[model samples]
Target: MPSADGGTTSLPPIPLALGGDDPCTAASKRTAERASWAQKSLSLPHAWKLSQGEGITVAVVGTGVSVDAPALEGRVTAVGDAGDDCVGHGTFIAGLIAAAQSKGTDFQGVAPAARVLGVRGTDERGTASVGLIAAGIRTAVDRGAQVVSVASALTTGKEELTGAVRYATKRDVLVVAPVAPDGETRPTDAPVDTYWPASAPGVLSVAGVAANGTVLRSADGAGEADLAAPGGAVVGIGPRGAGHFIAAGSSAATAFTAGAAALVRAYNPDLTAAETAKRLISSGPPTGDAARLDPYAAISVVTDGTRSPASAPEESKPLKLPVMSSTLQDRAMVVAGGMAMLVLLVAAAAVVIPRGRARGWRRP
Candidate 1:
């Protein structure tokens, strides 16, 4: 079985568990309580007040999603045998995208009202080729998916996958792909190279960001990361019978971005795929690596014409975003202190230069 992104295509490496046996060994740990943290971090609650990604369909093209998961109930439309996910990666991704938290828990997904079209690109053993992933994308598009989430990365370029991405984009479907999880031990047969279709053109590549909005993986220092999202310490359902998994990786980040896209699309149904992708990158707050996804800001950009769709340049053109710099902050703070001292000197009769913690003040 060739890895989709050239490394071992087993289950997504979910090693961080809040309370469980081993890292990924825990089968039934409920993480509903932790979902609020991620939601609040992304401001999903406020974004949902505007749109819960209603009337939008996101095709999760990865490991199959288990439809029977309690959090995902009534939110998934499995295409074929997608209801069964042995690796639980697909289900986890789907839960992030569209899990309905009707269970009165904090586990509400980014786009709880959105519909998830689960497409099983990988087999039971969590193995898939780039061609299979491409097929899954096309299938999701054919099934009326407005957004297509490609969870796997491919080491080698495949024309089929490229064509599939092009096909979806042509029809106004946003294609979101995450860089494959870094630091996982690659199989000896796996290729040592950058992952694709994330590296492919026309795909919205996302980098994983920790809760503090920092790029989680140091290797994401490449040009492929178009945007960043909260992927670290994410909580989502695994298979139906199994409990939740507190996972962290680029895959989770990609799902959150995809869910944001669904919300943007639902808010402005007429925006093209290029427009949506551009809005996400242009509206987000820039970190050192990439823009941290701001769902509310993106929606506001669309609704308020911060950058009108017509004014946006061609998709191939470069986007200039403001860099968040600590040096600039320090300089601003120093300038502010000097201004405050000047104001104090002007208000008082004399300049006060007391020092040494007021141990002794020399008379001038």
Candidate 2:
């Protein structure tokens, strides 16, 4: 078991794969007792006052989602055997998007009330292919998903994935995906470049960022991203237990953006898919190449499908104070006392001098 904060109770890291031919991810035995940094950074409670993504359905197109995950109970509808998450990655991603608050932990999804639809974009072992992901996109759209979160990012499959995105676009469904695969799945020698589906015209390609607001090094060469969200050291639920597992990558960031999209759709039911995307992008605080995802601003800020001043990155002005050394303070106090004495003398002179002038003629 993996240890965290020098404690044995913390959950182990979720495996992307076993690292061999036909590799599969293993199940985690422990659960994290605390909430993730992403949860605190998002401040979802403020956003929830306006919308909890109550009526929206976000599809998790990945290895699969566990039907019995405690936080996601009664909210997941799986397509075929997609309900069984052997790798646990899909369940983690789904938890980030729509898990409800539970009794034991402070962790909660971005959109707690939104529904989840599970579709397998990767095989049971977490292996992904162009055909499988493309088919999953189409299936999610067919199942009436308002927003689709794709977990896989491939260098190839431009044609098939592009077609799938176009199909979703025409049907007015928003698609969110990572700019590249997570560090675990990406090969060390792979060049940083645009990946398919994310490179497609209508998809919202998201990049991962650490708590410090820097883009994850794993996503450095993945080209420009449409937006950035917290993905590093993220915590979420496993396939079967209430325990939380930690993972990182652009896929986790994509889940956050997808949940924001759901919140936008839920609050502004009349906005088109493109408009909703515009709101998310426009409302975010621009951080270099990609805007940082701000779920509250996405729903609360007023915009005309364009960047608003409320969402612009505020220039950080330094707080300035007067130099007050001990020497200067003492001098200031002396000067103030001198000025007070002068005023008192002037008042005395004004009264005495006038009386003396009047008495000069009387000698009284």
Candidate 3:
């Protein structure tokens, strides 16, 4: 997948196998305001009932899942060699996708209601070949993963990764691809120019924002960024240990948002993945370009058919998304300018701290 960064292509090694799991120190539950667009109104935190993503299975396509983590302990189902946690990348992602551990513990993920199916696609050494990722996508879809979250970059063949994305879409899977990291939107080249599946139509592409509840002004803010979520600061399992930290880029945001979607699915089991996505958007605070995703707001949309409105961007329109692939939508700029069907190669995600790797400590 060359990761769309024009970098080298090579697969890293897998993590060692773990037998089972236990509970980590859960964080203390404290009610606060539902801040992210994932929550529409100024609602109390810990107020919205978590759906537990009970019947929903969210497949995380990454290095692999940490089956023994207290959060995902008995919840992991692997089609591969039972997957491992070599880099702890999958553990962090899986944790976000479906970690509902005790309060006060630092080992919980978003949308703890959902179940996770880990498909080990990437290897250690910080490299994920295109073939491994694509295969992982196929496996996730086959395993009944309604929402497939891909955090790695297109490090090898774009065709292979895109094919895998298309396959998942054809089977009614909702795929979210994170855009590659660009150099802070250089004035010469457009910001949205880089990255793969994120540029793909059928797939939902995500970008990051800061913790102050403000989207990154440096972010291209092109039409591709459907909705922005807090990516700058978070608490999750990293290589060395855990603390209040920030994970950058659309990769982190995608996992967080995917967890919200899982919660929505848990709340309502019948909605199609697309419908679920739309419902989620309808429920969250609105941004001119598109409605940012909000878990709390979505609950209202489901239960009351009304959600809070979003703040308007300078000239952002009240996005009227349709049902077909956003690719074919006349108004939906799925792929801007010259990247109609470009696919990225194999590579590790740039602009990101793999949570455990040596070189991933960048924070701005």
Candidates' RMSD to native: 11.4, 9.8, 24.0
TM-score of each: 0.73, 0.80, 0.64
Clash pairs, candidate 1, are 4-154, 5-153, 5-154, 5-155, 154-196
The TM-score leader among the candidates is 2
Q: Write the per-residue lDDT of candidate 3 for residues 101-146, one digit (tens) a residue.
A: 5444433566666788888666543346677778888989988999
lDDT of 2 by residue, 1-364 (tens): 3232235356667766444564344455655556667887887889999999999999999989989888999999999999988788999999999998877677789999999999999888888889999999999999999999999888889999999999999999999999988984455475648787898988888999887788888787687787899988788878876777888889999999899999999999998887788788878888878888999999999765363211433454567988899999999999999999999999999999889888774555
lDDT for position 210 in model 1:
70
Which window of ten consecutive residues has the lowest lDDT sum in model 3?
A: 1-10
What's the CA error at residue 325 for candidate 2, in Å? 56
Candidate order by lDDT, decreasing, is 2, 1, 3
Model 1: which ten-residue window has the lowest total lDDT?
1-10
Superposed Cα deviation of residue 147, candidate 2 (Å): 0.2
Once fitted onto the true fold, the runs of candidate 1 whose alpha carbons sit more than 4 angstroms away are 1-29, 102-104, 182-193, 303-364
State candidate 2's TM-score: 0.80
Output the lDDT of residue 120, model 1.
80
Angstrom error of the Cα, residue 289, model 2: value is 0.6
